[model samples]
Target: MKKLHVVAAIIKKDDKILATQRGYGEFKGLWEFPGGKIEKGESKKEALIREIKEELNADIKIDKFALDLEWQYPNFYLYMSCYECSLESDLKLLEHMNGKWLGKDELDSVQWIEADIKVVNYLKENL
Candidate 1:
């Protein structure tokens, strides 16, 4: 199976965290943290910054490394790094299915992609 390294941002503001829905691919309609695959020549933070700009038209400062996980999907192995981030500008979604600001208590309202469950658990415990 192909292996992919990616970064995801947990943008927390006040009582809510940002979650994005997939607009395409097998995971369409599933919610995920805002981020994408790490491109060649890009560091994890760099890839996350670039992806946020492309997907949300917003900027963020990576506050800290949150967690990392490895998961095997049907066709690939996913190595994902998660970060706690602070948004620096207004968020405007230019890509993907949908987005929402979910409170810690409301995290389970939407269906999350398989890989994001652990991150969500961490958030619930700490936030």
Candidate 2:
């Protein structure tokens, strides 16, 4: 199976965390965290910052490691690292079908992509 390495930001403001819906691909309309693929030679944090800036036009400060997850789909294997992050500027979405800031009680309410559901589960247990 092919493998994909990515970083996802669990962006928090107060008790709320940010989520974004995919606007393209098989994951279209599925909610997930706000980061993306790590380019070759780019550290996870560096790729996270770049992905957030590209997708939402906002800056973030990653606070700490949240989750290191591996999930297998029919077509690909996901190797994802998640980080707890904080917004550094106003958000301007350039990609994504929708976005939301959800409190912990509302975290599991959204329909999350498979990989991100693990992050949500972690938040439920630990946050």
How many clashes does each candidate structure show, in the order listed? 0, 0
Task: Tell me how far the alpha carbon of residue 117 in candidate 2 is from the true structure, in angstroms, after superposition.
Answer: 0.8
What lDDT does candidate 2 reach at residue 52? 96
Report every candidate's CA lDDT.
0.93, 0.92
Residue-level lDDT of model 2, residues 85-117, one tens digit each, is: 999999987889899999989997889998888
Off by over 4 Å in 1: none
Model 2 poorest ten-residue lDDT run: 108-117
Q: What shift in Å separates residue 89 of candidate 2 from its native position after superposition?
A: 0.4
Best by lDDT: 1
Candidate 1 lDDT over residue span 8-123, tens digit each: 99998988999999998899999999899999899999999999999999999999999999889999999999999999999898878789999999999999999999889999
Clashes of 2: 0
Measured by C-alpha RMSD in angstroms, how accurate is candidate 1? 0.8
lDDT (Cα, 0-100) at 105 in candidate 2: 92
